[model samples]
Target: MKQLIKNLCYPLIAVLLFSACGEEDKSISAPEIVGAKLVSFGFYVEDNEGVLDKDYVVDGPIVGSDIEMKIPSKIDKSSLIARFTTSEDNPAVTVKGTVQVSQQTANDFSIPVDFVLTNNSQNNRKYTVRIKRPIEWVKKVRFSEFQLSDAILKVNPVDDVPYVMGITNASNSENRKTVLLKYENETWSMVGDTISNGRPSDIDFTFNSTGTPYVVYTDYTNTIPQTATVQYYDGSSWVVIGRNYNDVRVSYNSICFDAMGKLYVFSMNNAAGGVVGRRLMNISTYNGGSWTTNQTMPGRNYNTYNMRSILKKDILYLGVYDYANDKGTISVYINQNGVWTTLAQGMRMDGATEINYNDLDMDVDNQGNIYIMGLERFDSGYKLVNHKYTASTSSWSIFATPIDLIGNTKYFSIGLNPDGGLSTVYNNLTTNSNSSFVTIDKESQTWTSPFIFPDILNTKADMAFASDGTGYIIYIDASKHLAIWEYIEDNE
Candidate 1:
């Protein structure tokens, strides 16, 4: 009886062990997604009838596909949809935050999609889907007989035309004449009369909502003090915005249009020993009629120089070089309900001993984020620094610097691209004679590789993007002629 019971126990134990081994083997053979692909993509346009569907062909990579998609230039990147396929059927795919196979908002300013795939056994893998703007080529054009020394190129947001504003050597007088050229029909035409009113020192150009061009320039008319005046192009002639305020000595001026089409002009007042001296910055506004002195910027000191200001929406951003203190400061002021309030002041490079700021430029994107770029000196070396004012957080922080940026560089300019990214043009000081161009990748917040234009001796180069996603760089070429490097989508 004992032997029979022991045999029964042994067989039961063997059967139980075999069942456990079988379960473990089954669990080890879990399913997995091997591959994925973006099969199709497009955008939806809403009309009175209904939503119109437009599809795009996907002929790019399969492994973490990097696709260069072309759409209508005016289309917003936030409104894009993508359809994808996986190696195995029923694997999950998601984009932008949605777990839908047909995903929308996948191409929001080059943002990568997170494609999460899960197999039958609940095993998962994630693939990144990148949609890039089509590769573009830079086209070069030389302007004959036009010297672009100390000039600026402004592009029309509506028509994509470029206007060149510069000073040319005058044959009649000892003074230089201000020239404005409009690019049309593949040629640059003089807009109006050559400005010979005063010695053109500095100038700024902007446009209103109705596509009207306005300019503010500093002029020294054979007098002891310089005056700044604002004017607009009225189809054929240049019309002055207001009576020239001659008492205040204007050193630098900048112009910008607000959301309501109202124009604002910021001028640096250089008068000495008066109430106006205490208020070194002056602001003027034009609301379709007369120009009015809106408000004056406070916190004035004799050490302030290289004052630059920009108006975005209702916020005014100001950057000034403090020569006396060896520092550079940026400030912000906002207009809320017709009342101006200072948001920030005296924000400078922290813990820097010697600060020499130059070529200060500022721009704002559609999201109300402000970017200010310039050169600053540090213990390591002189480097280009960008300070960003985030609208969402209401804070100021350092944006980014080029990875290869070196010391001894000058001529820093920043502009907002049509896709709401930032573009920067500067001279590489290490090379001394070469100019460099770089852009910020909105998705990654990283600077693109520095595009160095070799032997570009000039200290200034301006960059602007058109409405059709075309980039234009205006610089003085080796021949001292005004040249434009036009960048367009390179389909090939």
Candidate 2:
């Protein structure tokens, strides 16, 4: 790409001469130097702020002085360079400087050079140049199985975070392993790993108001019936808070906390095929010490598949599929006298008839309201349903389900903004195209497409949002490099 350099100089006198690139010419008059500095070296991208390599400092390139500087090329621009300098001073002071730009690919990328210059005046003189280049992301996003993938991006208070914690298998080989991730800084890194056979699944993690980090996931290990475990990180390592050996295979697990910092782990489980006669659906709670297990209400059990579980405040909720009737139902349980009491029975939305609803996803807001997003089937076709749970009366309110997400059946993920609004992302396939996006006003009772991300194609990776309400989509690019896309909201 072409580089535009401004020269900010001092006086009206100016001289234009073209010769092989050389050093700043000290003989240039004060006015020439000031005027030249006026339009110092700069770069820009359409509609974006100029991001010059601020690491470099330039007073001016003397008309005849040779100067060297390193500048970063915008990835979107073709490899090219342009140099220009000005000699303009706002306070009628003489200024002179030289500017140069060059292109460098990833292999030959050069370090930015700093031209240290003095104002030469009794007072300090500051010359500035704004640079802009095409916005570029990392070449590839690398993934490894059997490891945790947590990416902590820069925290901007105004953004609604998408997803923070996710479990992904970096590779698709026979030795595929599960990876647990936690985001801390601007990068997503591995934190914990489970055996390949215990393939990590249905993971939920969150940091309480006190900054205590907690996570829950199901591990399908041979030793114990595939079980759910709770882990907490105390600024150092992940420690298992609770472990069960009841021969109950757990699935579709989630973690949440109440206003009192109590931990709750909700998971769907089935008895050992040979031992227990009936499948068991449960919500387990840990009060920083012991674990208490609670089973779901009658009619909440599904003989064939897993159920999605979530907790808001002190109440527990679950969404299960009725394989027999081909319909989906939600149930809630409340704790009374330290025991979980079934508060509601199979509650179905107005038009929810199909029972084959899978990939059920749920989220809870600050006001103790619960929202669930999942795939639904109908005689005519398949559709998506985003429903809410009003805890005040233990009721279910079916919100608008966007039809655009019909194809994004698997890998469905959701989160909430600090204001209790909802956010969601999933993969959609269209013949040869794939796309994903977050829902608008996620917690609203209404459904509309005010904000939708561009369709992302061919991604076999996990996505997450930061806590500040901004959504970040992470995936491995064609070259296997981690690619990050930030969805930011503007302040009115």
- Among all candidates shown, the one with the greatest TM-score: 1
Kindly give the stretch of ten consecutive residues in candidate 1 with the minimal lDDT sum: 44-53
Lowest lDDT 10-residue stretch of candidate 2: 100-109
Instruction: Supply the global lDDT for candidate 1.
Output: 0.65
For candidate 1, write residues 246-340 as lDDT tens digits.
45677667777765567777776677653355326667788869667735655444344565555556555555554555456655565544555
Tell me the TM-score of each prediction against the true structure: 0.71, 0.55
Kindly list the per-residue Cα lDDT of model 2 for residues 373-436, writing each as its tens digit: 6566555555666767686876676665645534435555565655565666665654244544
Clashing pairs in 1: 136-490
Each prediction's RMSD to truth: 9.3, 17.6
